[model samples]
Target: MHLVVRPLSTVKSSLFYSTSSHVPARAMVYAQYGKPSEVLSRMPLYRIHKHTLPDVKPQDVHIRFLAAPINPADCNQVEGVYPIKPPFNTSLGSDEPVAVGGNEGVAEVIALGDQVKGFSVGDKVVMAQAGRGTWRSHAALPASEVQLLPGFNSQVSLVHAATLTAHPHINVDNVEHHIGDYVIQNGANSAVGQFVIQIAHAWGLKTINVVRDRPNLDELKEYLTSLGATHILTEEELSKRETRSKLKGWLDGRKLRLALNCVGGKNATELGRYLDHEGKHVTYGAMSKQPMAVPAAPLIFKDVSYHGFWVSRWTDTHSRQEREAMFGDLINLIKEGKLREPVWEKVSWKLNASEQENETAFKEAVNKGITGFGKGKQIVFFED
Candidate 1:
């Protein structure tokens, strides 16, 4: 048998490698945590003076951020309420040591460092972990913390790329329930909840989405139903027995297998009452700033489970390969047009002139509730 000889040039380009380039990177820096207006006003504006792409160490890769969303978690981080804190560095040309702000974004690989493997320049990627700055343009991170998506289609818009990073990993592939599997969510219109609804629908699961009866209820429900939501319920309806009785027909007397709770307090407790036996209630956010209280009866008799999830912590625990796989599936669904990003309000950020004005704009967007919040995710586009 003749041995097959492969060309060396093709092999080298397919693997991880770094090349020198003259691209400048910019970043948004914060000196301290406070209210959005105050803290964001204090953000120091800076651009790389020289092309000093940090020499990629064995496990590092350089990323050029395409887009990053202005998530509530990012606001919480600025307010000093978030659990994970970004490292503050004084050497970055700020008078006060500054930390970068941003949690979720999609990026493109510009270069790879020595000892890095399986990734190269021009690869589309997502942060394997959250809390790394994705606000500006470009970052150097561990290869283990960056997941490459070779099969990701560009048809998935930048807004969807930024927003999808906020969703939790639900094992939709192995989910035992089908399209009629009654799923309940409080923040039905939230970026994360919207994704949950779409993914559940694609997996043949039914959804009971709850939102406050804002002025735009009809429009919001129409948007969600377009994503396959089975029913929409307002907070007022969820509190009534008659409404709950009406839901029984949809579940066909079968209990709900999953409940997604972002707003806590009474809303969470009430949603807990509708779960079928052995169902799981996953709480990812405390939008109401209230603690969830579950009656012991459901816990002891119904054998329900309450789980709290933070995407940051989830990324830290899961391997990079696992994240790539999860994102691969998500991107595919997006490519198929089954998943879409919610309405996005763009906040333009200019270096120094409009920084203060934009900070106020950011705060205003965050203060809007339910349907009142403009639409979709609020994206900050930084321009040089």
Candidate 2:
């Protein structure tokens, strides 16, 4: 099924429409890097006025956003800590240069240029590369800047498309894989870790998942187990000798070919301990904010290698065709029910509300996400 853009007449406010080629839009803008709550509050809720949507160039496509996720990296970027930064520019109608706050989301094409090809007015698409600000209601982007989700059908939910870019399944696909191979990972309950477990299971790989023990540890374990985790343990259990013995028996002399680490502390070291010769350990996040202590034994004796996988960097270096191919594959997985969207909560954006009201709602959600209050990922869903 395709997503059609709503007609201008149906929009609640004239703030969203234009008589000329330029389209009116709204965005969460930040002029300087600092705390998200503070920096984001410096400007009015709708910093981007009607003039921001410059006339769609020959290579440009106009789009209306469906949803965008507030990822940890997005916060870090707003705080001036992330490695990649969106170029601060006056494209958003600001007198001074500023950047939008989101990196991942799904949008429907509302208009296209004469020079563009292979994309219809209603096709659903995602950013082809990182740093095109996504925390906005509309944008006129170059055709090369967005990638179409060819397999995006009715079964592929909006939540999955919005969070797809930052999902950990890309790491699972990038790492070395073979049927029957054993994979180990920490943060099994994290958004990325959950996808890793499901994808590995679908690919015939055995996964040993480690998580921090919580009050409802048993329930969490059961949920992950149902997702096809071959084994589950806590950080404390991972350090125990008996636990290692049990894992050894389960391995039955088969070695762990890969380890996906998000927590970078003692637990990460333990994951490396199980790696087979020439095994690869991929680190994608450091939730603990601590350095990983790697012993030289595995590097020297077992020939194990360590790597850091950042989705932004991967997208920047890969070709559009290659990136779209991966997107198509994951969308198909969702269609087949082999993959599922992460737990997430939506913050609604009412088009009819006052700008201040909408801004307050958006900031409240970001603050909750930064404080880690919610049980699921927080996403902004635009309402017509």
Specify the highest-TM-score model's number.
2
**Decoy 1 TM-score against native:** 0.86
lDDT of 1 at 38: 59
Off by over 4 Å in 1: 1-16, 41-52, 55-58, 91-95, 171-176, 349-373, 382-384
Quote the positional error of residue 1 for candidate 1 in Å: 49
Candidate 2, residue 238: Cα displacement in angstroms equals 0.7
Cα lDDT tens digits, model 1, 121-176, are: 67878777777777766677787777676476668787777766677565342236
Taken over the whole model, the C-alpha lDDT of each candidate is 0.71, 0.81
RMSD in order of candidates = 5.7, 5.1
TM-score of each: 0.86, 0.91
Query: What range of 10 consecutive residues in model 1 has the weakest lDDT sum?
Result: 1-10
Residue pairs with clashing backbones, model 2? none
